[model samples]
Target: MSDASFLSFLDDPGFLAAFVEVSRPRAHGAGLDPYDYDRVTAPLASAHDWPAACAAAGQRYAEAAGRAAAEGRGVTAGEAYRTAARWYHVAGWLPHPDREAAARTAADADEAMRRALAHLDPAAERVEGDGFAGWLRRPSGGPAASRPVVLVVPGMDSGKEEFHTVVEALLARGSAVLAIDGPGQGVLTAGSAPEPDYHRVVGRAIDALADRDGLDPDRIAVVGLSLGGYYAATAAAHEPRVRAAALVSGPYRLAWDELPPFVRATLVQRCGGSEAARAFAARLDMTALVPALTVPVLVVEGGEDVIPGVTNATPLAAEAPAAELLLVPHGNHLLGTALPDWLPTAADWLTGHLTAQR
Candidate 1:
């Protein structure tokens, strides 16, 4: 019965279509230069030949890297790095237990950061006086005291770059944003850092940001994506200074009790072999913790999100002291696709709450 339900959900045309549309762009964006989407989507695009397709993609990436390097000046080094990173992202998604694959993905992200640093002015300044990780993005064109500031926390398998798209949008709107690599995320993923202790880590991040110059520390808001949502809620609860919090395609609970069997099975298959994955899963259970959150929150869920159903939203709304839910029709787990349309709404919501408090 579970298998049948799983297969049925996977076969849903709407689900598959949304998944493909969101995933394809991510895959394409992962690489530096444009590649034929047809070739890239050939194998792993579907379950029938996912394994073989992933293997093929890995080979293509490796071969492409060599060719680009040989061509030298014709293909800039930046292109090479992008191509390699794209392959690494694909390699990370492949359903295989290869320690080397994860290591390579981490290494590629590190290299991309290096290249990015060389070209872009250092916009990030480290925050001292805290054990927790924190960084600030200065408001451009002199300090604007009236501008709102946002502190963003990423989900599992996420790093600072995940906010690249959103940060540009916020900055254009005259908002300063601070993004952090919290425990078990980003560079911490490759390090010996401890798994996230929700309230503690977030509290530290807030404490560090509170004293930064040009920031209306009291007007600060928090946006947590995916698993970061759980942490964000907890932080909002403990920190009375946070004016508002938003969760983009985020869930209330850590354990995916509402996930369809196939999705759960897929996760198990993906992480089953890794001790680290197993440990991560075992520690993530936020159901009991939701009731403790007292801040005003906006829960954004995809209408067709198969992993966390409508039921998840209900409990969150009920549990949160003050919360509202926004369902994006035809949206999926990846929030960026709908961000351009939804961010304005989110920004307005944050603006109302943050600015009014002042």
Candidate 2:
């Protein structure tokens, strides 16, 4: 990477360093051991070099996965495939000046995810509707007699491929997972765009899961990250069937002026344009909506988060009929660094709430 480019990577508006650091744990979640993450990233000479290096790292892992599959090491192969998917995803992030390259990397990441899911425990089933797509995974040992289902929603840039760890955690507690790509997210962005009333999408997802066998429709829950947090709460408030909701670093209202230009641009693109995005952001206020959340609600926030900040958790929990706020003193956005502290707890809370109603 050029010296100028390196400085750009360190620039505050971009928050590149923080993005890379936070993404590390996610790569680990994708099965790249810590040592591998360091080894692959240690050689990055500049900001521009990282993506190409990351793409190369993914290729190397993909080759390894192929070899393992040939040797009948299904579990090992699955791990490698997942790791490759993460690396490819990392490359796809902030791919500037080369939109075509970014698209290709993103497609490769999705393919790797599919390959990984094939070897995962209980396997994952690909599900689709008119304008949405997702992958569903049952509990490890297979569906329980009557365990609940949790719909996992991703934030602006995150996709279903990055949610394998969340799925595993929920499955361990006997809850099946449906990690979805809503309108304008992941592979579901062909003709649709992001909407303020995401409950419309959530309601449809619930409808699909309700008709499925082995899942308890009455115990369904929604768990979201960042912007997804907003979507989850809105869904629970508007959809009477959503028994519980969990929000991780979601904002009650969009800090439009506070958002960085690039982030704002992405929002506009996802929301169909500037006017629509602004309209959607304006409609995101949960002041009146949170009071209607009749079911259990879990709001997790990091004290150090700059995007949504710790304050966003207040009104959410205060208005909800049954709600709890977990504040991690040193956590960042999505509480990525605090996963060990929050993931299990969030999963347990979801299980407890769903089970209590039974």
Candidate 3:
């Protein structure tokens, strides 16, 4: 009864628990109004209708942005465009093995975010290199002084457009920000396969950044969320430039047999086959990597974020030599439901380490 098709995948009632009410929290975190979330979900007749509903919502915001732009309302146009991008991102966030609608929507989100940045952060620079694409942005005033950098890595089925708050936070802290989509991620997904050796991707990103003026090549931190937390930990262990690290909801390890149908399907598709996914899952383990983290490391955990068949990052923190855990008892996955409680605190922790680093 289980199939890789997006429709069939969602139609399976057993798969529903993978993301119990995940849409609303993610939507809220992406800046969508609570009423807008209701408007989008309330009309969906079934789980299969989610993509279209979210897509329609994205279109609505996109059209509103067009009107706002034409009417010379810069701020309104920019905000609407950004909201449209987030909606499109949400629409594509599902790990649909089929990849058709999700691919198109991811591209839409990318374009919309690019437009949004024109109005919001005109100084933002697009950075791209092998297996990575992102924006490298400095703080508001300008890049007058060489500043430490913070690289933001998104998790499974997430892209750069989804983490504006992270970027803004680092910028506000007087650090440069590079938010990227790696191999098999975001717009780069269609032609690429999921890579378990994510440190290579981080290395390539650092290679691109190391020579840039106004950036302190020696001081770079990484803030990774969800699966990206795995990448950040791996990079901190291997990439010497990563002086500090923070992982939110990252897995300590992945077991193919234990994963839910939705996760299995997504991995099968992203990894290109069952065999490849199994191999990749094996590499997701951080047992040997955490002990190598000589840099300051922060692990953020949501007490309610537990999902069946998945190993959360809590144990990994305990093992890392210099790791600290920020466990939020009331928070859920991504902590979108409890953003105010964790984000500022996490951001402060990262900035403190980055600035304090000699």
Predicted model with the maximum lDDT: 3
| Candidate 1 segments exceeding 4 Å error | 1-22, 25-96, 126-135, 142-147, 192-196, 254-287, 308-311
Ranking by lDDT: 3, 2, 1
Q: What are the models' TM-scores?
A: 0.69, 0.87, 0.94
Encode model 3's per-residue lDDT on 67-175: one tens digit a residue: 9989998889889999998888888766654477778888888888888888887878888999999989998885499898989998877888888887887889888
Query: Which structure among the candidates has the greatest TM-score?
Result: 3
Clashing residue pairs, backbone N/CA/C < 3 A, model 1: none
Superposed model 3: Cα runs more than 4 Å off: 1-7, 13-20
Question: Which RMSD does model 3 reach against the true structure?
Answer: 2.1
Q: Which ten residues in a row have the lowest lDDT in candidate 3?
A: 1-10
Candidate 2 lDDT by residue in tens digits, 1-358? 2212323433454364555676675566544577877887776655566668888988988899999999999999988988888788767455344545655676777788888878865357777775567877787665358668899998776677676778889988998888888886666643567756788888888777766667888788999887889889889889888999999888888766666554565566566566776677777778868668888899988877765312365567777879999888877777766778888999999988998888
lDDT of 1 at 287: 67
